[model samples]
Target: MTDEVSISRRRLLATSGSVLAAGAFGGCLGGAPSEGGRSGLPSKVEVTMTSRPTPKFEPRLTHVAVGGTVVWTLESGDHDSTAYHPDTYGPNRIPPDAEPWASETMSAVGETFEWTFDTPGVYDYVDTQAVCTAHEQIGNVGRIVVGNPELDPDAQPALRPPQSELPRIARTRLEELNEQTHSLLSDEATTSTEEP
Candidate 1:
């Protein structure tokens, strides 16, 4: 026999090249196989706010860890996300009743909101609809420093109003210094009523 039929075709091509190298090493270490083949718990962070170039509110600095859970997805226009506790959210700092841990109003486009901090602190938010007219009084604002690695030395530092109530820009030398302090208080009350 031809040396036992060339050693049985070299043992059937080395057992079909070791079964095609173990099916390419198990498909490069087992990938593409989820549903029921089970293996999915990875996205511990994802913050999106789409609508290309015009409608804002993307990432805007979002990070999670302590208890972790922030799933805000409003991929287009129309938005809302109140959460103002850092002293009434903003401008003139509105802390009278301060109630608003979650208030996803007007969430039209795609609409999705999910929050879960599990106590750490500092979670100011905004965007209560009028998306642009003053856009939450300019800057739109957002901050959620849960599990505090920093901000929260007794919090209250997000919108520290008191710079003469911040929101200015109407000057002609501040309107001629308020008309020379109203013409020196009407010439000091007409020279103090001719001195008594």
Candidate 2:
């Protein structure tokens, strides 16, 4: 029995040490964004949907590498992440070759929907429930930038027809998202080019 206890204690200590080490170096992990380069892009990101204090998608904008995946986790209230595509009764705001997606209503807390983005481009999405339309009217929309697709920043999908047909607040938010994506990717390009 003493030998058994000793072995169990040794195992516990080893596990604790490993946990502490991992915690100490957690920031060095791959998922955290790095400075000025495509290498900074994450392979996966989580977006949260909340209803209290007004319905909204936390982060509002996400940046991921090509083939990266985004998981929409419903933290509170009913929500679904739906892309802005003709099939969804909206303009094509995602990459021309990208497949459109729409998550079913997730009403339970902690429920989630995920999609892997294969094409490189800017994509716009929203929680498309009628009750949430009011939330959208106030700019509760989301956008994702998958990799860096060459796009005329000024002519981004948000500024085009049908997509441009979104509510003024939603349009404004998307335009801001587009500008941010352009700035971030452009800065990365400039830095990479300037490096030796």
Candidate 3:
């Protein structure tokens, strides 16, 4: 009877130990944090879509800490948080370990797509959908700087994306936007007081 009890107790302990190990292992994986409170998933960052005097991301550049998430809320215009992954027809800029991820293209006002940056790097995204003929070529894009503010692309850390990708007007506009984002250059760099 004593031997049987000892065996039963050992089996229970072994089962408990395995369960605990599995739970701990899950956190180490690069998956989005399930227990955001316990696993250091920081509060989400938000960027709204704006279309009126200007058709662009409300905040073209976003900053977040590692493990932080960014949710792009579409206030207006058809948009998505399309990461620059091979699948998206651009070199990836997100962290090397991070998988290429994107929010579905949505146009309804108030629709949103969220992504967690589990690793550290810059994640450049674009809204490729055409809105009244304006498209990604016209500067419907944005970026999330994770952990490193001085971030470069994941694959070509040195080479920047070519300006030829966008229309001439858009390329110039995006350059101005990038300058503004890269530097605290101007709060109204993209904004124009002049009548369009």
Give me the candidate number with maximum lDDT: 2
Superior candidate under lDDT, 1 versus 2: 2
Report the lDDT tens digits of candidate 1 across residue range 1-196. 6999999999999889966774453233221122111112111344555546644455444434455566667777666666644433434222233334555554576677876665544444656567455444544445543332332223333323223433342122223323432343344356456555
Candidate 1 — what's its lDDT?
0.46
TM-score of 2: 0.75
lDDT ranking, high to low: 2, 3, 1
Each model's lDDT comes to 0.46, 0.74, 0.59
The TM-scores, one per candidate, come to 0.24, 0.75, 0.60
Q: At residue 186, give the lDDT of candidate 1.
A: 49
Q: What is the C-alpha lDDT profile of model 2 across 1-196, one tens digit per residue?
A: 6999999999999989965763443222223443223555778878889988878887777777888888899998888898888887467787677789988989999999999988877888987766645666777788887776666644346434336578898888887876766676686578569668
lDDT preference between candidates 1 and 3, better one: 3
Tens digits of per-residue lDDT for model 3, 163-190: 4655666556555545644452122223
